[model samples]
Target chain A: MIEIFDLEKRYGFTYAIRDINLKIETGEFIGLIGPNGSGKTTLLKLLFGYCRPTHGHIRINGQPPSPKTNSFITFYPEIDSLYGNMRVFRLIDWYSRFFTDWNKETEKKLIEFFNIPLNKYVRQLSKGFRARLKLLLSLSRDADIFLLDEPLSGIDPASRDKIVSAILREYRENQTIIFSTHIVSEAETLFERTIFLMDGSVILDGKSDDLREKYGKSIDTIFREEMYA
Target chain B: MNTMEFERDRPIFLQIKSAVKERIVRREIKKELPTIRGLAVELGVNPNTVARAYRELETEGIIGSRVGKGTWVIPEALQEIRKEMIEDIIDKFLNNLHSIGLDSKEIKEILEGINDRDI
Candidate 1:
């Protein structure tokens, strides 16, 4: 379980996220959606303990989040951190040394499924392949809460399907996943719930299906209307 | 299952349920239904979503599962599912007809008209 109470992250007298309170149960798949600069990334960073909260508190599993909690929590930052010069298989070996929960079998299966060449350097891979590699690394971990930031930001429709399927395959029954994305229509189907943020505040938070049924529109449509209206 | 199409505006579990109900109606699903996990993987959807659909089907007596034996279509599952789904279809149909400015009398006339046609 994760709880955020009156959470705020500020920079130079301006708030990135403000007055937020939410409780996310275990095994829930949540989508954090908003336009650029809506503090989606800032909120995720606070939960992962990468950034200190300016006010209020966030607790994970009844305890305040800390760096030590990194062991059980896996966070995938939006920025690409993979070394370009390293071969694909070698990077897997390096990641295994840090995460005890790394599943080698899943890594091997994903490699085959994505048809990724182990011998090629990361720099030589295409944008789609790079995206696939990033996802493979994230899903390799057997973590409690998976914080994924923009997993579908840049990629063709074909590769997006593959990446989405890979995510579905790696989902464990006991895990809690919160992923942020602006491309709502493509990924909205997989979300159990969604949190709509605007200008550092939550505008709406509810079950994805309930929101759909209430508005008689897709989540994407609702977001566009709320944001543009 | 892969051949099934899903709409973007509705709940995914409903699409899964409709697909399964269609198979049952066509007699494609016999004594045994596919495991929830297997069908989820095939459809590339969350297993929990498929579980929800299966649970609803079970509640309606269209399908049942044992502890270790797995899920299967119940006897007379077709009639059970059809009886439940047809009412919803008719309700929607009537609501749509009304939306087009048709009253109950016009709807009754359309139903009578349907009886005269092959449809």
Candidate 2:
């Protein structure tokens, strides 16, 4: 479980995320959705202990989030964090050394499932292939919490389905996944609960179905009406 | 199995439940329902979602599962299930028709029109 208490993150005088209090239970698939620069990345980074909060605190599994929290939190940043110069197979070998729960069997299966040419350089791959590789690396780890930032963004429609299918196939019963995306229509079906962020704060949070029932429309439509209203 | 599609306007488990209920009513579900894992993969939904769908169906006496035998339609309750489901569909259709300001006579006219068509 992740517990956040009055969480705030500021850059100089400007705030990125403020007054955020959320409690995510175990074994949930949460969708964090919003427009650009809505503090989605900041909130995820704060959860991963990659940046310091200006105020408030976050707890992972009842402990204060620190470097140790990284053990169970597998974070896929929105940016391209892979070493562009490295070959695919070599990169896998290097990354597997960091996580203790790296499953070799899962890695082998995903490697074949994605059908990524292991001999190609990471920089030489297309955007879709890179995202697949990143997902392969993250999903192979037996982590308790997964924070994926826009895993489906900037990919072709065909690759989007493949990526979403891969995630559904590999997700375990014990893990809690929080994925942020701007493409709400495509990703909305997979969400049980959703958090809608706006201007650095949560504007709405609830079961996706309840929201849809209340609005009498799709989550994407509700999101647009809420954000634009 | 073909990939089951879902609409984004409502809960997926409800859609899954309705789909299964439709199959049961149509007698398309013969021996057994698909395994939770199999259906989940086919629909690209969480297994927990499929499990909830099955649990609700079981609660409604539409289906049941036994250990190692997998889930199956309740053959004995098929007639009752059909009655309840048809009633539900009619209720929804009538509600929609009334919501659009149609009275009973107009609804009957529309029903007659539908009956004349090759449905």
lDDT of each: 0.87, 0.88
**On residues A1-229, what C-alpha lDDT tens digit does candidate 1 reach at each position?**
9999999999988999999999999999899999999999999999988889999999999888886677789887789889999999898788778988898888888989888889999999998898889888888888899999998898888888998888888888799999899999888878888999998899999988788778888899999999879
Off by over 4 Å in 1: B84-119
Q: Estimate each model's TM-score.
A: 0.90, 0.89
Summarize candidate 2's per-residue lDDT along B77-108 as a digit string, tens digits: 78887788889989999999999999999999
| Count of clashing pairs, candidate 1 | 0
Clashing pairs in 2: none
Show pairs that collide, candidate 1.
none
Q: Give the fraction of native contacts in model 1.
A: 0.44
TM-score of model 1 vs. true structure: 0.90
Tell me how far candidate 2 lies from the true structure as C-alpha RMSD in angstroms. 3.1
**TM-score for predicted model 2 compared with the true structure:** 0.89
Question: Fraction of native Cα contacts kept in each candidate?
Answer: 0.44, 0.48
Candidate 1, residue A91: Cα displacement in angstroms equals 1.3
User: Best candidate per DockQ, number?
Assistant: 1
Q: What alpha-carbon RMSD in Å does predicted model 1 have with respect to the real structure?
A: 2.9
**C-alpha RMSD values across all candidates:** 2.9, 3.1
C-alpha DockQ for predicted model 1: 0.54
